[model samples]
Target: MNRIQRVQKELERANADYLITGTTSNMYYLIGFSEEQMERPLLLFITRDDYFLLVPKLYEEQLKQFPLIVYRDGEDPYSKLNLKENSNVLIDDTTFSLFTIEILNRFKPGRIGRASRILGKLRQVKDDEELEKMEKGVKKAEQLILEFVSNIKENMTECQIERKLKSFLIEEAGNISFDPIVTSGPNSSMPHLRCSDKKVKRGEAIVIDYGIKHDGYSTDTTRVFSLGKPNDPLILEIVEIVKTANEEAEKHVREGMRAKEIDYFAREVITNKGYGDYFIHRTGHGIGIDVHEDPYISPDNDDVIEQNMVFTIEPGIYLPGKFGIRIEDEVVVKKGYGKTLNMLQKELYII
Candidate 1:
């Protein structure tokens, strides 16, 4: 069956009368149209038998191929959509709350649910075209990261490195998924640390966590570096532990395994090394049209590991007031094992 057919089958199983999605990646997947979210909500309405798009009249000329329900400015967009009363409706999880509330009040459906229940499972398993595009995007990102790290100099501020990396991504990758996480020294302890003016110093860890966007897909990667050997010997120990954890987890990924099992494979390694408390956050997350998506590799997730599903295996250890170490790579689940898409070695890059 085709994509829409598959969604119809899911909707049947969910006992939902229809599915509504806003201008999000979910809409991009269902159809080829991609538009930014605005007050004028561009929505997709899908049923077991058919599907159509609802958009502001401004998009009428641009989207001429598919059936459209066009509404004028300052007009009630929902008024044209004829929804069945007392019927179960599924809405895309990422839809804006304003639109969601309007949907709830206007439709008065018997039940409202997240479309992710049907869409997430379908989106997790990628096809050949998607894997090929992601592989190329990930390889280019790996090259850019290597180049970016090679040029890192002592005393350069984190912001400078981020600026340089952004230039590299825009020049080669076309776009970026999110702002780069550039941190050094104690700042590295915070996994989500944003770029700052802190100067890069010798004997300190530097974490460059970044992602690139290509062909509407995303590539996420992280690598820890240092101007020289870190001042704390424990830094090297934690780096080794993280590296081992990433490798072990990737090595054991097999179809039919639970997503949380993958998390355990990595987390057990870190915890066994005696840094259980220091290792925060899940092992990884799925990457595709959006940087973060389904099949999240976390301690509590029980989603099955299916073939062609792509995700990340990232393991880290943080030592507050000292530094942190992390190694991340995107992996594609195959028949018997998971294969990493990254070409760069996970070894700590020492300048």
Candidate 2:
């Protein structure tokens, strides 16, 4: 009843006969319902004719808002499925584990295939309501980060700073989109390093990567800060290179560009500076209800750009045993432009 029309459209495009899923995000997008994940599987069945939700008796009260087919424990939930031989079934590979797969095998659908790509592509393009919420939530999120950066000082341990940062986000927003990344000195060289007890030294690169969950959307961005100008010129060099790569990619992205083109564009900038090997990870990823989704802007992807698709353009350079730098911004694809949602300075801040 919610975005069923979109699913219907997808059915037509995908040429599928039926759809089934148990993922929470897919449930939210397709039906405006988010089920609590449990050991007992919560199943959603969508056909050309109707929608059905099958869950254990315990969830019957919680699902009263929608039409559901409830079953008791130890009962054969498969008894309720309506399927025939040769019927194509689309399943969320991530959600439907082997346990769930075995249950579906009873239906004997002629074919079973991954349906995440179909849903992921559908989720890439945002409607006005989603865009409004994202913009407002991200603007407010930036202020909280500014507060963190302004108060940060030398000799603070990375874990302590992470705790304070998480505390601020938990106070302002109920959740984090992902675990925050806080690293300094040698640890900073690892792009995905989490917080540690290591003290943040002055005159070294410090990377802060984090995200916030607000208004049903997630905001992701990274900012690099320094207590004082590092004696190592390579750190500044890499930071400047990454900033330029971020800005260049954002400036040149458009509706017709291939997802890989953006990645290539950013990669070229880093490669020219001779730090290409040190720069790892994709240029960006589709972001919305889920922190990472479709339209991956990577060197290997072939997905084309379209207006209203929101994602990120993050570029970084990591020098092992030295330091690292990254500049990230959430961007929306427009007809002839890419609109970045974040307003934070990409330049390394000398805090």
Candidate 3:
């Protein structure tokens, strides 16, 4: 079913009169347009009987082409609605600003239902169109990674590498989903370390974790490489262990399986290698409009995996004061199995 049909069904089931918001993801999910709403709020007033999209007066001509959208000037959008009392309003917490929330509250005397988790649940399971967009995003990200590795040089500063990667992504007309992480030597141990001025030296491990956004969809990936020959046997050993863990997690991922089981699958491999403590974070998280979404893959989560859900299978072993190795790839859960979206090799590379 199409996204509009799915959302309509959910709205009927919840007995909501209308869904209001200015969130770009939800707007794109419902409508096809994902362009930035300049200065003006893009409120989607969805009801069982009608779908109205209110935008700034400046964008009236552009939005008017959309057959279903009922354009309204941003200065006074509510004037077009003429909302009735006792009507149920569904608001997305992520995109609803304080001023908008106050305006919505005035319409409904009682407390309104924040459709934060509900929208997340809907977005977690990708439809055919969303999956296709994400696949394109994955390919773009892979191409950018190849470009980055091919131009890598010895004795280059970590910041320089990050700048090169960012340049490549921008050149492809894609926005950075998040800040690129370029850590070398002992800095690799920090999972979320930002790029630094320190230059990468010979025989030092360089970790790069980054993502790109395409058509409102995101693709996340991580890879580690050394400037010269693998000097530390332990680094090689840990990289192999992480690769095994990541593959094992991907192998067991499928529909109807508990999210925690996937985490355990990877954790078992790391623990068996006597580096469980080094694997600090969760195995992965759901990837879609946001890099991190619902039904997180971790020991604490009990949500069952469903078909069309895409998430990362990243396993890492960080040895503080020494180095770290991490292998990550995005995957989508299939009916009876899972398919890895990233095609890059998992083996440690010597640049």
- Which candidate's TM-score is highest? 1
Candidate 3 global lDDT: 0.82
Residues 209-240 of candidate 2: C-alpha lDDT, one tens digit per residue: 89898877888989888888876887777888
Please give the lDDT score at residue 342 for candidate 1. Answer: 87
User: Worst lDDT window (10 residues) for model 3?
Assistant: 66-75
List lDDT for all candidates, in order: 0.90, 0.83, 0.82
Between prediction 1 and prediction 2, the one with superior TM-score is: 1
Candidate 2, superposed: residue stretches over 4 Å from native = 96-99
Q: Best-fitting candidate, measured by lDDT?
A: 1
Report clash pairs, candidate 3: none
- How does each model score on TM-score? 0.96, 0.94, 0.88
* Model 3: lDDT of residue 23: 45
RMSD of 1: 1.3
Go through the candidates in order and give the C-alpha RMSD of each one to the true structure. Answer: 1.3, 1.9, 2.8
TM-score (C-alpha) between model 1 and the true structure? 0.96
Worst 10 residues of 1 by lDDT: 142-151
